[model samples]
Target: MARTPTASAGRRSRTKTVLMGGVYVALLGLVSLIIAVAVATAYLPSYGELTKRSDLGQMIRVRAANGAVLVSLGPSFGEWLPYAEIPAEMRAAMIAVEDKRFRSHLGVDPIGIARSVKVRVDSGRWRQGGSTITQQLARNIFLTNSRTFGRKVKEIILALAIERKFSKNQILELYLNRVYFGGGAYGIDAASRRFFGHSADHLSLGEAAIIAGLVKAPSNYAPTADAEASRQRSGVVLNSMVENGFISAAAAAAVDPAEIRIQQTTRENSVRYFTDWALPQLDTLIDETSDPIDVWTTLNPGMQAAADRAIDAHTPRGVQGALVAIDRDGAVRALVGGKDYVDSIYNRATQAERQPGSAFKLFVYLTALESGMKPTDTIVDSPVTIDGWTPRNATRTHLGPVTLREAFSRSINTVSAKIGAQLGFSTIADMARRFGITSQLSTFPSMVLGTSEVRLIDMTRAFASVANRGVAVTPYGIRKVITADGRLLYQHEQNEERVLVAPWVAAEMVDLLQSAVMGGTGSAAQIGRPVAGKTGTTSSNKDGWFIGFSSGLTTGVWMGRDDARAVGNLQGGTAPARAFSAFMRVAVANRPVEQFETQVPIPDWQLTPEEQMFGDVAIDGNVLESMVDEDGMPLDQPGQPPVDQPFLQPGRPGDPSQQELDQAFPPQQAPPRANQYPQRPPPQQDPRSQPPANPSDPGAQLP
Candidate 1:
């Protein structure tokens, strides 16, 4: 009996111990749950505070070198306005469009959230967001640009905390200050200013509705990007306002849609070509800081306008062209990459490499002139074949004998090839390199004809060197950058170096180029004043170019199709020259007229036999006084041709004057017959027959 009682007592004691342990575990679990809830509650308010203090709502402005606002990087936020400051119509529009239960809900609309969950569950994806205004504000302020459960949860927690700490009006005010509207505008006030160019307090009912509509998709409804979409969104907001009892249907219908005006922000985002080229130069002058910096450049707004107009007028539809203008000192004054910069951001002036064509011949001629060759030197214009490559003149027919000056003026291809062969190609290539033709030069002789490709800006710089008397100046866009407080951040000085030809040689080349504008290929580019220029038409007319310089400015224009095809039969002498002339006409209208120095007089010895022959050959005074027929035999001193008989039987050999006519037109008969004609004996070869080779040799490879 004693052992049985002991066993029962042991069993009862074990049961009691088990019951006590269960109770203790339940109590500990309850304590842990309470601690977790407390920690979450504590972190929620801190997250709200963090959202309030973040700088994500700030606006970032980009300024031009001349202190003009080019673009606003971030939201364009105006001054913070209280809820009271916001008009009732604006508030009503926001409530009707964004969240109808904004006032009654505790930061989360249960109905909206339930609908969003149902959508996600049905579609097996999170495609829709049911964020209230407060939640959106929280995300914009404190969260990263992510769409994940953790981030959503954080946003919700912050929103709940904000609602708990502030009244409905205060939360709405904060939300109004933090929302993003497209076009770099943030908050209701900035949106009002950006879209209407007015303060939020001055917003009309239709304007307020538009701003509220932008809350759904700012970029899609942005007035600047899509005016029709903005108008459609505004209609939706107006309908919502009527459905929510915020406005009567009759009053909404009475609103004239035409009266709603959307003032586009004229901040300079459209002129990206100029900014892209000028930004790097701007960086050298300004420090990285949030404060506004003003940059001053040498750019002339009028010149830039003229460049844009000229490009638009001359460039064919769907074709692309770029223009760059520099002052006498090599400061870039204007640049236009294409017809519409908004359609494409690639700055052709700095980025594209196209063949410069015959414009490059100037460098070749300059090189030869520097090497003791005169403009009057004679070069054979006959067929020239170098290393299996035959370069023909634009017109296949060649003048038997031509001076260097005439060859350059006429842009004769065979003569240029011959000149390249005489002067080592490497010498001309080296001169081009020194003058800032940084593009790769081909080893073949075609480089003498500008087979190498170059950018517009580089070509402008090279031409500017010629205008600046052989001193190559680095082209700069930004002159100086200053802080908002007027402190100088950086400044650019005139960085120049003497390269390639000497000053006198450069001056002489300039004079010759002026003749190009006066009567040669660049005649279309003549601007009344003294202008020196060269025209370049690439292979198959794929590219057209006109690079010219006046007394104070140098401009380069390029016209061609963006797809690398030929344009509407346009050559360098046509559209590009016209555009260059138009821009120069406007740019230099106020500047004083200046003349290029004339080339030094050619010495007598440097004259070639052909030039000497032409120098003495003269037409009869009677022929000059009256029109004559095809035959060289003079008409009867003025009305004598009426009785057209065999005049003097075409004088025989040994006739002094007849000898000159025979020399003029050599006999086309066989060689044996030529001996019978009145041809003067061939001149004896001088003992100094080994004259120096021509300075331009097409066979020689370029450096």
Candidate 2:
């Protein structure tokens, strides 16, 4: 084992050569790895890709007349926020929780990654995301949310590329706007509005903390779902901010998540019917190629809430209903297409065409008045037969001779049919067309009784025309369209209004409608103000409708089953008129009492001995409380609806209703969700609003 000095020297030289060779190989691998990273980073998405906007599409954000977001179609990215408009607290809170070294890091934060690894090892779970704000932005825009090693490498490369191409502020904006805040909300503006009821610009320190805390697990912490969990998460975010020197301990200590003011919402799901009805008109209102559009509608949230309340209160279970409220100018204030949107999106208010029953008498009487028949004129209410068809009054027995006003107020079917026949059915059809009733007309002898099916909107518009003093009312919902940044794209300009009737005629009609409410079937619709309206119920109790106006607001209500089956004991004067009263009470609460545009005095009419027995019959709920006689057989009352069948099948040639056909051959539909259209929601409550103990956030799918 003894070695010579020369051999020992040689062994030392070999060892030094091997150590130097190993050092050279290590340096070569490091340079190659650096080159590989540089190449991958260079190939990452370009600056425009990282900075691309999710709102660039023709996204439609539907809003209430008061600028409250109602619903959104397509990408529901909240309105964009510039770097300056982004709240300082929002920025600080997010950075303090998500990445402490975001301000100093180039793109990847090694310290954050190391800390995340240690935390994961210690806790045996992922406690921190470890990615810097830039990296998160890259992953959100370019890469998927995968934990694969290849994905991590690509995320780092893209993050470096993003940091190289964009400033830190730009990266922050992208990340904040792109991050999901749960409950379908995206972006701080939307998340803040969804949870805090205000925009991010107005976010308080507590609110900012709550929103920042959602990044870790949006679904788990959304205040709309669990206020306590969200509040706890907010505390964690506040503590992190204090630790990071972003906020003082005293400042964080003063915050209470429960005190955050969240906007109270009613049953807003029904408002989507308004949006669906208005969305189609967007293409006609403005260029479809414009930037993201903010569609301002004439929908009054208060009125909408009122309508929802009324429907929920009056509409019984297993029955569907719809309501449409419009201003004098035809600005649709509130529209409920159906009882539940998710159960059936088939909008009964706008799309369903069913027999309007006595509601159609508006046209017949309008024609009679236009033909110079005064309300004081004498008319016979006895039975009549025409073209081998006989129509019977709802009472089965008719009052002999009654004043025109009396017959109209009592919803006398024979009187209207006689007058319509005398004036010619063609003339009545012309009058219906003149007043915005667009559905097909049967024009037969019984057609004057609303035997022909018509759309609720058309029927509502006709009554609106009468309330508007004979000016045609086009029910419009969309008020204007604008860009996200408040640039005007379209402003609704009403078309020239055609005079459908002389002012005096309109006054005469108003007088007639007023008489109906004052002393007839519409007695239940009084809303502490003079109301002019008519109630309609189809045979077999298939449809119930009430169309009326009060305080310059005209509202129409329709209740029916989609399958057109009979609804037991439900009539226009009972449920529909009651709902109308409830809705108008809220709709006109603020407006000053408004009188009829033109009030032509009604001449006091002398009633016959027989008619005198039923004189002053305009008692409250007069028609509703007595819908049936002693035998319990269906009583045929004008607005209350008679159970008798029509003279002829209401559907003749050219009156084929697609709604009926669809009902006959029901189309395939997915079963409604378990909670969709939950049984008669309590009045003044949102069905889906599952606010936690704090109730800081109502469950509105924000984004």
Question: Evaluated with lDDT, which candidate comes out highest?
Answer: 2
TM per candidate comes to: 0.63, 0.77
Q: For residues 23-79, write the lDDT of model 1, one tens digit per residue.
A: 898888667645644454566555345324236533444444454445565456666
- Give lDDT tens digits, candidate 2, residues 219-269: 899887788899989999999999999889999999987787655443547
Highest-TM-score candidate: 2
**Which sections of candidate 2 miss by over 4 Å?**
1-59, 74-88, 103-106, 110-129, 167-170, 183-186, 197-202, 597-703
Q: Please give the lDDT score at residue 629 for candidate 2.
A: 74
